[model samples]
Target: MKPSTGRQKALAKALTALIPLAPFSDAEAIREAAGQRKLRELPPSIAVWIATVAHVRHEHSDYDALLDEGYDRDSARHFVIDQMNAVLTTWRATRLVEGDEDEGE
Candidate 1:
């Protein structure tokens, strides 16, 4: 595998910092950090991992909805991740077709 580049490393570092915040947010920083394209620029898996962890930690509706649908917490998490992956794949494919290598700003 290729070595991680500076931006890739930065992405990792950002996640390291952001993750501890999980369910809490400071408005300005939260807006700024999330507004930065870096979050979206991270590899989809990593991005989804962060989102899932945060959502699960906060017990967001997405996670709860699975429980409402009869999935146990463990099963719900797996189900959400699988669904996220499918959607992410479709989004990437759509971006490729649009010829905009960047997913978006």
Candidate 2:
């Protein structure tokens, strides 16, 4: 295998630090995915965010099944927002949804 690029190594380190509460297998998988060629083009923070959100959406929520059941994309996302946010909270990542009082901030 090719040696990892500096960007890949840095992204992996950032992801590990960002999601310390995530399970070992999940955390490693997210880091591996974030180091992919496409994601490496983005800023590390944004890549990490995307990878984490995707992991939560697919693994921690019913998003795929909702889509399979014919829920529209937006509606499926809305239905799983709470479950997604709960996983985010557990991992100490920023929650995607906010309460009304958080809106003005």
Candidate 3:
């Protein structure tokens, strides 16, 4: 489904500032996924967050392999949290802090 042009444009604008550290291809993929979520009526920020995390989980972490190995979803995600956060740091989506709590899935 086609999201409204206004929302698309706005999302693109937000993403430009949000993920300046991301490579062009990664940014493009995130934008496309976020746009899909936006079409489902999620708020742009929420859509972007979901898309970004999913991308990091699938592309930059061992999440899928862990799942394939019979780990439950939460357990797999727990194991991959640090890897996911590292990717988010590279993308400028988050920063590491000493003593910071886990960012829940």
My TM-score estimates for the predictions, one after another, are 0.31, 0.80, 0.79
Off by over 4 Å in 3: 1-4, 37-39, 94-105
Compose the digit string of candidate 1's lDDT tens values, residues 16-99: 343433323422233334334656666543553444334332333265777788988766555565454444343232211122
The model with the greater TM-score, 2 or 3, is 2
Best by TM-score: 2
lDDT of each: 0.42, 0.73, 0.72
Of models 1 and 3, which has the larger lDDT? 3
Output the lDDT of residue 38, model 2: 74
| lDDT score, candidate 1, position 42 | 60
How do the residues 1-98 of candidate 3 rate in per-residue lDDT, one tens digit apiece?
Answer: 23369878777766766666888788888888887833448767666666777787889899999999999987887788889778768778643322
How would you encode candidate 2's per-residue C-alpha lDDT over 1-105 as one tens digit per residue? Answer: 222888777777677667768887888777777777778778886677778777777899998999999999778777888998888778886446543211100
- How many residue pairs clash in each candidate at the backbone level? 0, 0, 0
TM-score of 3: 0.79
> Cα lDDT for residue 66, model 3?
97
